[model samples]
Each structure stands twice: as structure tokens, then as C-alpha cells.
Target: MTRDNGFSRRNVLRSAAALAGVGGLGGVATASDGESLRQIGPADLSDVPTDLEAVPAAAVPETSSGIGPGSMLFITPPGGGEAACTANFVWTDDSGTTYLGAAGHCFLGSSAAGGTELDEGPDLADVEVRVCVDCQFGGLSALVGGLRGEVVELGDVVYARQRTDDGTEVGFDFGLVEVPSSAEGLIDPSMPTWDGPSETGEINAGDTVVQYGNGVVTGETVLTKSRAGSGTGNDDASGSWTAALLAAPGDSGSAVQVGELGAGGLTGVEAAGILTHVGTSGTAGTNLQKAKEMATEAGLSIEVVLAG
Candidate 1:
């Protein structure tokens, strides 16, 4: 794995991208029996509230320019310039409010700039979600190659969870941005390239996992940006799971699914978690089931916007 001296969140993301190509986190965990942990199991979300508008077993209309999972998003930190991150999943509440998922850290300013510390969360009122057009095609060159795209103000942030409450138990490092009604038509709940997070799924040690990350450094090329790896297991009881999938700095908040690859892309996928942080051994994600529970506790009462 490639190593970098910098520990800032930005550099940490880039390092993860580099690790993707060379067999990530060489020592990621495996099952105790040394056998595959892959299994067909569904998460128990029968009690969770779902979107009132979702049609069961219906097809999700494809949108060429819609903003959804895999879209590039930017937000300005308190004292710093704009930073980029990927959207994880789409969510909705009974009141008909559409919310986009992202890492809580994406809304925070760097510690060096006198912003909230990396360990702490940002104030929801202070965050603004900006969706970027034409960013995927140009990558970083878009900024200097004169191919820059405009950033559209989507809406204000609704919630950003503090990583920890009492500094002992870890909290879910997730955030949600409200997508206004005027721009709701631009929303596409499906993931790019590899589709179908058919439903919430479970993650176990050694399970095969696939992800498509939109880190600026990885460019938007499907073949390069999409990755397949195996699950390492839960990092702890904090509603977090670990995996060795390919990722980069801007890939934070990208969705990960428990699935297998087929001729087309992913087949039989179950939305498992949202990418949050990276470690020396693997990447950590907020389990989707747990994220929903946390959102419910915060009075959001949301359901994952599903793909047909």
C-alpha cells in the first residue's frame, strides 16, 4: 500500500485511492474459519419507515443528467475554500422531503483552519450542499483545463452526526442534505454503472463487496472508479463496518453494496453501508441499518430511496 505523511482528511482520502490499485490494506481481516463469509441475508427493516412515494417492484426511470449517488458534491468549510465528496444514498421522509446522504466530515472545515476538529461534527445549519455539473468528466483538470463546471446550490444540510457524544462511544459519522422540491426531478436514487442496492443487506467478515466511488482523483471512468473487494468485518459496535474496497479522498460518503460481479456489472446487490473513514488496514462505513436507526432517533424517519 502507498503511504503518505499527511494525516489531514484530504490526504487520507487520496492515500486510500492509491491503495485501491495495489490491493488495498494488504492485511484486511478475514473470516475465522477461513471460508467465504458470503451469504444471502436481508436486513430487518420491516419496522423502518419507507418513502410514501416509492412503488413496490416498479422501475426507476433513468435520467441522463440527474444528481444522485455517484454525483460529485462540493461544500465550503467555514474558513476554507470548497472541498469535494461523493453522495452515498438517497433518502426520503413522510413529509415528502428528499435527502441526500454524505459523510458528516464533508460538511466540516479542517482543524488547521480553526474549524471543528476532525473528531467532532459540524453544525447542520452551517452546511450548504452544492452539486457539481461536468465535474465527473474532467476530474481535477476541470479546474485548470478551462472545462470547469458550475456548482448548483441544492439545499441546506438537515443533519450531521457527531462522531462521538461522550468521547467514549463512537457515533455514526453521517450527514443528510435536503433536496428541495424544485430540484427533486433531478434526483435519481439508483447508483451509476452498477445498479440495484435492491434492499438493505448485511455485512459479515470476508463477504464480497462492490462500490463505485466518485473521488476526484479517480476520474469518472466507470472501469477505474468502480471497485470490488471483500468485507473485513465490523470495526466495533458503533454501527460501523470495514472493507478493503478501492477508495480515494473524495470518495467519502460513497455507497457500498454487498454483491457479486456479473457480465454487466453488479448482480443481486443489497445496499449495505456508506463509506465514512479509512484506516491503515481498511475503509470504514456506517452500516445502512444503523444509519437508519440513528436518523430515526433524530426524528428524521427516513427510508432509503430504492432503485427498481
Candidate 2:
């Protein structure tokens, strides 16, 4: 499985549990309103359905637009702080609402009122989604906190959830941030360094995988943001998979694609999963297919928004 330097990532998560701000990271960019917002935790695992609706394969459109996969997501929860997470794939609902994919844990802060589990709660509000925040300026620009881009006011957290068994976060922690029509011009469905996630596919134990994340732990540097690693296969019945990729605290919610990185990044890539848990065993991801199933159970009629 993906391994880090035994860093108590869970502790980092809890300490920075709100997953709310970039300001604390020093010059990363700050929320303008600076007002308090709501925190949504994961729903019960049993709430997911046994028989889920089959989502059709992602349809590749002739054209795609702006900031999307590989972009940074800034979340500000109720406690008045902001956190950063990497945007995964893009999705669209039947109603024409565009949603950016992220780890459910990204919005999780402290626990729902009166709830003890970290992964239990309702939806989130006032989330600030910034696409290409400092991507154009490159890592140097981001490091010095020069020209951080504008915030894209995507709609609220339409659907977010995580699954845990016996109080253990086994897998399946993912969420969707609805992109408003005004921000459509900035919504590109393609992965940045590595391109095609032509369709959703499975990951085998030995298959190679590629990912790009904008975690603060890596200073949001381009060099370490994109990585390639090997899969360790799926966890037993948890609808999650493990990998040997390099990951850090803010790397959560990054997309994991099944493919190989050629001289020009990933070639013939397929969306596999979203990085959720990073620990001693490895980096665990909620399988892309399983995530869809859970979304279906939540009454969301959506499909992966493929790149051009």
C-alpha cells in the first residue's frame, strides 16, 4: 500500500480537522467572507444500498473547459477556518448542474452536532471552490502567495458521504461540489498533467496508477503534486482499494487513475478511485464505481464528466 513516513496524518487531520482554511498555511489564499460555515460528516455506511443503479459510462464531449481535475479546492467549515484539498474528476447531474469531485473528508470538521463519529452528518454550505488558484503562476508564485486567483462560487455540497465498518474508516469517503452555471467556463473535465480518464475502470493489484494533488503538505508544488505508483488491490468488501503511491495530508480527494505515465504524463488513463485514507497500510481509495453506486443511492442522477 502507499506509504508515508509514519506521519500521524490522522492527527494532522484532527488538529486541522476542520479542513477549512488555506490562510493558516501562510499566503496560500484566504476566504473573503471569512464567515463561519457548516461542517458535514459522512452518513452511515449501512445507508448505502445493496443493489445500486448502474451508471452509464462517461460520455466524452467534443469540447471541455476551465479549471477542473487537478485543481485546488478550498473549504471553510463552521469554525471559521479554511482547508485545502485537490479536486478529483468532474461530474454533471441530470439538471445540468456541474459538480467537482473531492474526498468527503475534505468537508468533515469536528463531527456533526451531537454526533461522535467523524464521518457522520449533513451537507455543507458556503464552500469556496477556487480553480487554477495559482496553477498559471506555477509553484514559485504559489509559494510566495503572490497572485492567488479568484474564488469560483460553486453551489453547495449536493452529495457527500463516507463508509465505515465497526467504527473503523474502512473506505468510501467522497463528495461532490456543485459548480454553478456562472462558473461553467472554468470547468474543465480533463486531468492536468495526465490527461485521459476516458472512462471509469477497475484497478488490479499490479496495475500502475497516476495521480495529481495540491496538498499543502507538499507546498502545493507541481513537481511532487503529480505522481505514479502501483495498486495493491481492493480491500475486502469495503469498496475501497489500496495503492503504493506517495501521499500527504492535503492530498486527500485526489483522483487515482489506472494507467502508465509516459514521457508526457499518463497515457490511456482510466478513472479508478479517489484517495481517502493515507496510513501505515497504504493509501486507501474509494473505488470510483463504488462511489457512483453510493451517489445513486443518495438519489443523485449523475455521471462522470469526461474530458474532450
Candidate 3:
């Protein structure tokens, strides 16, 4: 996930202090107007459905089959901060274990500096990852269920070149998370709101593509256009692609699918890359091919689930 500058340490600490004053860290409270806002715990999946069949017959949240791009993922790092990012595709390992792909930095305490591997000291093995079940195309109002998982594994941190707020070109980030077995059946291998059951391929410049992310406002059904291969050959960050897609702080880990628009719409869509960082001009992503290779090196096999 992109480091939210707005959520400074001082602000976070202040929020924690305020919560402590109100009740406890994970307490629930009602505003003076009577609206309820509760502190969510790792096990507080009360809003999530316990059965896949129980999900409404509506959009079938991106977490389900036709696993769409903007699926909402709630990530709790080991160090005690909670954040959210969008999930990419659903893949299965050689042993038939399923996992949802996402940016690895979602579990980090801070953004990794350019040219460095993500420090493994955060104990990501138990990092909490959850997906909302009752999501719609424009909002997450329907209360269905939540699928909870953990970050069982992660990919290498490839340097993503981008210009900072001050226009300084610097290196940045990438990674993935594994969905637990318990929540596997709740999701499908399809891209939400688009054409899919697609393949994985390289993204070329000027290539029209669709980007998905679940921002705080957009939920998990937001879609935007991006042109791949736009910033190719201009930087040393090999195996990475640049696009003009608009991304927010919560859009980290969103997917960049490569495909063509046909008469049927979004035909041949496939997993191309995972959004790593949002720069002043556009977003940078880690090549999906490289991600698969990294998974293999780590003793895992991944395949995009296509709509049959």
C-alpha cells in the first residue's frame, strides 16, 4: 500500500490516544447523533458472511469468482497499524492452495526505500488480510460477510522508479499476499465488472488497459484507464510498466490487466502487473511475469483464474 502521508505518526498516535480516552483501543462508540462506529479487531468479521452461498445475488463481490480488480482488502500489519489496499487476481499453487495476489508492501510499517528488499522482520506470516463480501460497483454499503486470511508469503521488492512530490526521481516498491484456505471457496478466478478468466502477459506502451482499485470512496469496484509501455526505456527499473492511471493512497496493490477491447468488451484480459507506487505523473507496477517467477523461486506456482 502507498504510505499515506496524511496519516502521520503524530496523527496516528493522537487517534490512538483519543480512542483510549473514549473507552479502549478496540471499543465501539456512538456519536452524539447516534451513529455507531466501532474499532474493528482482527476477529471482528461480524460484517462478513460466513458462507459463500449466503452472499447476495448481486455483483458477487470481486472476492468471489470473476475475481475483479477493485476487491477491498483490509490489511493489519504485525506492528499494530491497519491499512487497506486493492487485490489483484486469485491464483492457485502447485498443491492446489489458493491465494489472492496483492502488493507486498501492504504489510510493511513504512515504505521501503528504493533499491532495498522489504525487511522481513515484521513477521508477515501472521499479518491479517480480509476481503469484504457485500461490495457493489460503486459502494460497499451492503453488509454481507468478510473473508479473512494472512500473508503466508511475499514476492521480491523490485525497484519502481518514480518522481516524488518534489519531482525527484527515486526508487520505490512491490509484493503479494496469500489468502487462507478457509476463505478460498468464497472467491472466484474472474475479474469483476470486466471480461476475464484471462491470461498473464507483458504490458506494452500505448497499450490500453484497465486498472482496478478500492479507494475509500470507490469501494472495490472502481475502474480507470491506463496506457502501458508509456514510460518504457526511460528508466533502469526493468520489468516494470508505467501508466497514466489515477490512483489514491488506498489503491496500492491494485492490478494492471493487459487486454484488448473487442466487440464483447474487455476480451482477452489477463494479469499483467500489480500497482506498486503512484507518482506525480502516473503509477508504476511490478510485471506479473516477474511476480510469477518470484513465486516459483519461493516454491509456489500461480495461475490466473479465468471465467470458464
Candidate 4:
């Protein structure tokens, strides 16, 4: 997901979540007035009967917190000070719409009480974010990706969940950050096919193919078990990668390519909705279709608005 903030990324990071940011990430973001603003790319808060509604998929038990922090981990951009508490974020109906999001607040100081004080100024009042879900979460790289983001055993100065002002947030961990180039990383392979090339499907067992994302640069086969299916969850096909490519936290919302020449015309991409799985060690999930909806919901559609 993404957002526009006049404030330098340096000023948009908070300190509280910084500590837990890298380790155990909880809900975080910014807000304006009484609304919680979100920076995540085009996401639809519309309560649709999506597959995500039936999370935990059939493979993973519903009771399993295998999805969000409970079901699994979903990536969120901080919208306020060092502590983008509830105040920092503002959602019209608590359903998180990206239009009102602000990253400046995410980088506010510890003293910024939720949003009592527009600590970071008004730079981030509005912006757009791009993201993809339902792509690579459950397929194969889940376990490895989750554990990898959870903890990197790199000894001293370990930057697991370290907080960062806009500056540092970009490289929070050894992950790839998809900075909205074209409408590329923001489409769902499963949703209706886009104009030119498009990709979709589940990265699960018996799914032979290679994936391309910021992580493990080289294309590699999917790797994992109990992958995500047609649930309300991500459209990312799960799989087991025998080769070695890595997925990192910053790599969320990146592209996931599978096809001939080790590249398909278009498929789902990668996202961070998968938080528990051995195979996901270095990867995540993505759904371009959802991203389009989000864009439309945030008023950043193709008709008008700033360049996405």
C-alpha cells in the first residue's frame, strides 16, 4: 500500500511501534480530525462477500492465527508520529480508506497523542497507495518469509523491526519496496484480466512455476504447505521453491511473476498478508484486482487525480 505525504519520509515515522515494528507489528497508521487515514494503495473498504471473509482457508483451521497477527500479518504504513496510536489514524467507518492517509503523522514524535496534536503538520492529509493481495502468501514461501521478517539472526545491530522516520522506513528490513512505477504491481492476477498482459492463480501444491519479486531476485518455484486457496484471502498461488530466492518485509506489494521463460504474461504479485508459514519465509501475497478497487474507492481512479 502507498500514500502521498508532503512531509519527508524521514518525518513520517513514529517511535512506539518502532520497537515492536520489526518484531511483532500491530495495527498502526495516521489520522486527521476524527478519522483514521490510510496510506495503503487502492483498497476497497466496501464490505463485499470476499474470499477473505472466510479466512484461514480450508487447509489452515479457522481458529489458527495463521492469517493476520491472529489470522496473519498485514503490512501497514504509519500515518503519524513515533507512536501512530489510534489517534494517528482516521477511518470514515473504521474500515480504513486510503484517501485520508498521511505518512507525516506516522513519523510524529512520541508526544503526539494519537491525533490530538497534528504533530507532523499537514503534509500527509491525502495520498494514494498501491498494493496486491491473494498472490504469493500461502503458496510456498510463507514459512520462510514470515520467520525471516520475524527475526533475522544477523547478530549485532540487528534491524529486525526497527522503526524509522520516512528515511529509514524504506529499508526497514532486507526487503523490496515497490514504489509504484506503472500500474504494474497494483493488479490482481485472478481478477478480470487487465489490458495487455495479466496473471492470476493460486501458488499451491503441484503448482510448478517460478516467481519474481524483490526477494530472491532470481525466479524460483513457489514453496510451502497448506497454501491459501480461493478464500477471501489473497489470490496468490502458494508453492514450494526448491531453488533459493528470498522475500523480505519491505518486499511486500512487490510483483509476483510466473510463466513461460520463467515469466508469465501477468499473474498475481506479492504482498504481506501472510504472517505464519515456513514456506513464506521470503515472500508474501498480492492481488491486482483488489488494488484496482482500492484505487477506485480512494478517488484515485484512471479518470483523474495525481499520477499513480
Best candidate (score: TM-score) = 1
TM-score of each: 0.71, 0.70, 0.62, 0.27
Ten contiguous residues minimizing lDDT sum, candidate 1: 37-46
Q: List candidate 1 stretches off by more than 4 Å.
A: 1-64, 110-123, 133-135, 142-150, 166-171, 261-265
RMSD of each: 11.4, 13.1, 11.8, 18.6
- By TM-score, the candidates rank as 1, 2, 3, 4
lDDT of 2 by residue, 1-308 (tens): 00012223443444244233312221111111222212112211111112212112232122212567777665664443445567788888788778898877666554432122223464456444444432532222232233234445567776665443333343457778888787787777777666878888877789998887755444245566667888878654667777777665556677888886578745637888888665443466688887787777677777888777
Instruction: Give model 3 RMSD, 1 decimal.
Output: 11.8
Q: How close to the true structure is residue 264 of candidate 1, measured as C-alpha lDDT?
A: 79
Per-residue lDDT of model 4, residues 1-308, tens digit only: 11111222332232112222332122233211122211211111111111222212334322221111111112332342111110000112123211111222222222222211222222222322222222233211222222111210011110012123342221121111122223223222221111112323333333322322212111111232112222222332221111112332222222222323235553323222211111221232223333333333433331101111
lDDT of 3 by residue, 39-59 (tens): 211111222322322235354
Q: In model 2, which runs have C-alpha deviations exceeding 4 angstroms?
A: 1-65, 113-120, 126-128, 133-147, 217-219, 261-265
Off by over 4 Å in 4: 1-205, 208-245, 261-283, 302-308
How good is model 1 by TM-score? 0.71
